[model samples]
Target: MERILEPELMDDEQHALAYAQADFVEVNRGFVDRFRTTFPDLTRSRVVDLGCGPADVPVRLARLLPALGVTAVDASAAMVRLAREAVQRAGLGASIRLVRARLPALPFASSTFDAVIANSLLHHLAEPGVFWHEVQRLGRPRAGVLVMDLCRPASPSHARDLVETYAGGESPLLKRDFYNSLRAAFTPAEVARQLARQLPQLTCRVVSDRHWVVSGRLP
Candidate 1:
């Protein structure tokens, strides 16, 4: 927690991010597709979505898997508020509950969830070890945790340039926001190395384009 980015600040960024990525249907679908393909046995499991900005994942999951219950959590209060609003608007108020809480110190009990997922949340953390241990604690003994993060750039400068170019004339604030996200990204190998050392029981893999997925039944 001490080493992690302040969720309070990042949460505000997340609210803005929902609009920035509002049309990112491909990115959102990519994750949903991958998770289903990766875990076909999962019919309607209880799911926990970490760093669930604007409540997108939970809302989507509940739509895709009507039988499942999804709990979305984020460190940002504003983001959680947005998430709750979104869930309620979707008429899925009973299916998803958005909570304002930081990762690596989850409020739920052990074996509380059938599966846990994190999207673009790992790199913002300064102490990923705490993240692994805490998420492990919340997971069912043989349940899964799906993780997605930006692949560290081959060249930081190139990445920055790409972000600036994609960030068409928003504002200095918006431009800085995109740049910070790229800077905070972690490479697939780097993520694997870190998880291997901390969450030895989990398996980490890279998906198409810009995402990395880490998951396995906890030992």
Candidate 2:
């Protein structure tokens, strides 16, 4: 299937914004803990987060890794503006910097960051391969890419599990958004396939049921 250059504008931007505000605490815990455990050695390292949304993860990363300098980039101008405000609200105006850049073309030179993370942003992409290629281009050999997205269900039970977990106790709009994300998400196998085709030099793995952290050194 030919891919649309830009995926549909998020269905209900205001609702999405509201949902993020309400659900961010719950949604961020898993990713934050996972990152903390996964990258314990990081200190004063340069980290860049793509598709930073409201910059929640970057804000958290700044708090968690005070020695680490972070640059958060997002395609949405509104989101970047919100992210800037979020950083300011957190009193991290001195540390976390926000940039507006589309994912297809990261505004950094090759091998710029020690780590890169994109949370809940992959599913919105119409062409994950393009984004993956760009990610590789921006990272050094040892840089890591931590990606968290909905898991693709392989059977009825898996599907039911996801619906129950992600859609439970949410607004109608939130439930609908979760369901759409699952439908759009790539399976671990699919992620691996794309990695092989787009970033064969990288060591990529699905580190959790609903999380994939792809990392490796450049050959």
Which candidate leads the pack in TM-score? Answer: 1
TM-score of each model, paired residue for residue: 0.86, 0.84
Model 1 per-residue lDDT tens digits across residues 52-130: 8777777777888888888888887677777777887899988887778876667898889888887777777877777
lDDT of 1 at 35: 71
Clashes of each: 2, 3
For every candidate, C-alpha RMSD to the true structure in Å: 3.4, 3.3
Give lDDT: candidate 2, residue 127. Answer: 78
Q: Once superposed on the true structure, which residue ranges of model 1 sit more than 4 Å away at CA?
A: 1-8, 13-21, 164-172
> lDDT of each prediction vs. the true structure?
0.73, 0.71
Evaluate model 2: give its lDDT: 0.71
Against the true structure, candidate 2 reaches a TM-score of 0.84
